[model samples]
Target chain A: MERIEIGHGSGGKLTRDLIEGLFLKYFKSPELHSLQDATYLPGFEKIAMTTDSFVVQPIFFPGGDIGKLSVAGTVNDLTVSGSVPKFISVSFIIEEGFPISDLERIVSSISKTAESAGVKIVTGDTKVVEKGKCDGIYINTTGIGDVKRELSPKFVKPGDVVIVTGFIGDHGISISLSREEFEVETEIKSDCAPLNSLLVPLFDVPGLRFMRDPTRGGLATVLVELSETSGLGVRIYEDRIPVRDEVRFICDMLGYDPLYLANEGKAVVVVDRKDADRTLEILKSHPLGKNSQVIGEVTEEKGVVLVTSVGGMRRLELLEEDPLPRIC
Target chain B: MERIEIGHGSGGKLTRDLIEGLFLKYFKSPELHSLQDATYLPGFEKIAMTTDSFVVQPIFFPGGDIGKLSVAGTVNDLTVSGSVPKFISVSFIIEEGFPISDLERIVSSISKTAESAGVKIVTGDTKVVEKGKCDGIYINTTGIGDVKRELSPKFVKPGDVVIVTGFIGDHGISISLSREEFEVETEIKSDCAPLNSLLVPLFDVPGLRFMRDPTRGGLATVLVELSETSGLGVRIYEDRIPVRDEVRFICDMLGYDPLYLANEGKAVVVVDRKDADRTLEILKSHPLGKNSQVIGEVTEEKGVVLVTSVGGMRRLELLEEDPLPRIC
Candidate 1:
């Protein structure tokens, strides 16, 4: 019943109480309480570090909230970089008058996600602004992961095949509806989740070339980046890429390309043709990736081209403008 | 003549353009473009990691802007934790209609500060939200530093000397007046500079026990925390503590305790009495620590006690409420 007051982020007694009663209670660890400005991570020789600031509007949406999105987003970022997430630092900017209950729920979600991903919440900070100065809460999660191998476009080749883990655009569409700006409704849920467990199995595939979570610019953007960075072209079979009917319907109504919509829980993997079937099988075995499919292949050409269902070809260029701002 | 649009944060073409044109133009480095979701930090066996979100109002202030504060703040956090600040990840949440010029200025400041502090801006993220949903901008910086030695409360003991780097309350007073909420005005400027250079010397002192940048809750709050955490008492002579005349004058008029005001560029160091003189000498040699003074000592009792200017004793308790929010 104790709602969050401005004092709770004051770096004073109330802030300490909130951290101890809520954060410490959930994220109990020795390094977390090292009583230093920064937590020490020992034996991290070659580590992958990434940072993301999640500012999704409405805070919560179908299947996930900002807390879950934050954890999954950073973890996926690290996982795609060929590292298993080991530690994370979660910092929050809470608006005054925000409900403590909501914060508790968010923290609980973070704990569950971090636990599932086998990452420790190591060090963090919280700051509160006056009411109306900020929305509800914006979380910045920076994670450090243990690198098992180096993954980069430098390793991507012309004969690699692209695999998408499950349906795309669910997160973007779900969050868009949650905002209620369009007055439209759907049963679509966000695909927000950590792909580390699902990805661990695919690392064993010797032909694995590239992996990336198409979060912000979705599948097309990732392909474009891959093409541009690695100087290789891509050809995707549009009919092969999975899109939930509800998501496709919403996109059609809005005239939005599903390829450009953000996805929180999906990954686009590029592997050699020889290992494509095995990679797809590994992804399909995971509950979150049951809809996995081989969607495309890398080409010697210099741009991303999509083949239509009727055998027509369309160019999937980089996203030019913002259709959604707070979709993440 | 260009301004930042919502598309620039959409993580699409415009976003990519912004990164290449603005961010990469200034923060260009190899690690930044490693083309991985996360940058790999090699040879970091023992490192310290910390994160902070800076929402300082009026992004540009007298002595520093949000960008400089972002870099310096994170660097100081890592520095005080006994680490040589090395790499940083900068994340920004900008309002859609924010001026591109202001952002350029902020980024320019960040580049200079990071360069001076001997740290690299390795990874980053940018998110744009609709205007009015957020203030002009908020920056979150997470840093990784190499830990040369362990710094903790367990190292503190009775008879340790408490030394303050320089004048207290300068940053708080300067920012308070910058808001122009109070009618009164003064010439106080923010003491906002990176203290890593000033601190490297003290690390060599055999008796050095603890060091912290007295930021949000200021000197009193830090003393209370050190006392509580170490299970040792702190006694400071009020007369020996340094406060600029303008800062003290403003504090007097506003009925604010200078001890409780923030100091962005100052440090509170505790060292064994045997090495107190040597530490003080080293600190005073640095420009940022020219006014360093030994104002307090650790005691056998277990709470913070302040010696009044009138030969009286006053108990300094933990900060109860926020006198000012978003000061840094």
Candidate 2:
């Protein structure tokens, strides 16, 4: 009805009209129209839903694009819950004058990702803003899955050993290196791989406490969440945490902590000490989890502490600030 | 890490990074990481999952914003499935420099909508792009619910009477009129409201068939889809379809049909003729469906046909081109 500009995306009355008039028009599914925080699904013994947004600069990075990440990230969220990731709804916001080629590529990537995950892209959306309004692209993917196993966000507790699926901070570091405009002799790669394959074995274990992928804010944030959820503390030794040499070097040069950087294809698992050894063994056997390590143990205290390499103790706070803006 | 340009949202490699890095980081629910299409959720029972996107220009229209629409649209989708709305996930892609006030309004709207629908925004994501990349804001919301009563996409059949929930084309007409360039006064108001409250009475009917909302591509697209999915055709009398006088005048003036124009808060129901009268009665009582009307009948054919006001017949083809480009 009007020439769209960046202002339209603002949460003003016109924005509302666009959603009501255009979005709701094509996607008439009832669950979405309620405009609720979470769609209450009554029939399942367990339910899984996930939300994710892409703010990657360049839209496509060295290894993957926002489209792939949007789907993968959402599916993994559901997968770790031991739910079968079933449906995903994608939303895309495009700036005007964007090349159609890129849209096709992204859609193709989404199709490929969906096929790989054995899911269907039943419905999706696209919106366009005028030129000079926003960045290149941003993607939001919400996923739904049905709980297939007896899993609970309730099992994590103190004294459980923490296991990381693979090497840490590759994703964040790779992006940083590319963005820093610094010359590096060593080649670095992002660990943006799928985790469903790795989860297959972990689900076979009966006493697995909890599992979460460490993306933005990395292992620190997830461990803190685990502790807060379980009302427990966590203690991790700096020496034991795995870090790729390239990531470590970049962090050193950038004065960053690999611990706090994001990792695309990694997970941090908290399990009963009895199940700890088996979990690590299981993770190490998988390609995605090749650098698997025992990063920490749940603590009885209410505060999260990091046992340093110098034997000094300090707290690992929730990443107080975005270490690298839009690294995801 | 490069200053995001419009090319990134083009759906290429850059889009993938934005997704993998940012989305997976904050939202990191396992199912999300799988990068799937339709998530392979567990159980094939009566579950409803709906997807909608908000690309409203001038977000925060007269009555609502994209946030409200994000939640409302999803809720309506589930309601159409004869399910009580439950949970919703929200995702946002915002351009840099957008005012925070508008976002608060939109988010507040979401909270309000969720509360009203008795659903939760269990998960959400946000992304900020540089200027010149996106409009102000765009939202994608996905809603899921458990169907209490038996419902399926194949519920429509021959001998079923088509019932519309309310006046048609109000949303399209209102939005068009509301646009900045449109310089005419019109009493037409967008029909943007949740329909879950109206559905309770009709869902349990002895022979209620399929149900859907005619949003985008309007009534014609919805009826065509109904025909295809139900393996049945439909014949509608133009004179019987409900349209506010002002809306019809606006459409006529603009060379648009109420059938092809969008309706925000509306639905098309195919119910047993035995229950058609009762369905109309129930719909008429609900505030959201007060103008409910019987519009057509399902048939054994495979496509939709519209009987003109003068008794001539014309095939109502599904929309093949983007009418009202970027209308959403």
Which stretches of model 2 miss by more than 4 angstroms? A1-44, A82-86, A94-101, A111-123, A128-136, A148-156, A178-182, A204-207, B1-45, B148-159, B181-183, B228-232, B299-303, B310-314
TM-score of chain A of 2: 0.83
Fnat of candidates, each listed: 0.85, 0.30
Taken over the whole model, the C-alpha lDDT of each candidate is 0.89, 0.69
For B1-328, candidate 2 gives per-residue lDDT tens digits of: 5343332332223444555654444334344444422233334355666667777656765555677677777887788777777666777776656665565566667777777777755665556555755677778887777676555548776888988887888877766666656666767766777778888678778888777777666888778767766788999999998888888877778888778787768888888899988888888887888888888898898889999999999898765443454444
- The residue-by-residue lDDT of candidate 1 on B1-328, one tens digit each, is 3788889888888988898889888896689877466988876778889999999987888899999999999999999999999999999998878999999999999999999999999899998887676788999999999998677776899999999999999988888888877766567778889999999777788889999999999999999999888999999999999998778888888888999998899999999999998998999999999999999999989999999999999999988887987887
Q: What TM-score fits each model?
A: 0.98, 0.81
Off by over 4 Å in 1: A181-186, B181-185
Locate the minimum summed-lDDT window of 10 residues in model 1 chain B: B180-189
The docking quality of candidate 1, as DockQ, is: 0.80
Candidate 1 has an lDDT of: 0.89
lDDT of candidate 2 vs native? 0.69
TM-score of the second chain, cand. 1: 0.98
Tens-place lDDT digits, model 2, residues A162-183:
8888778888877776675776
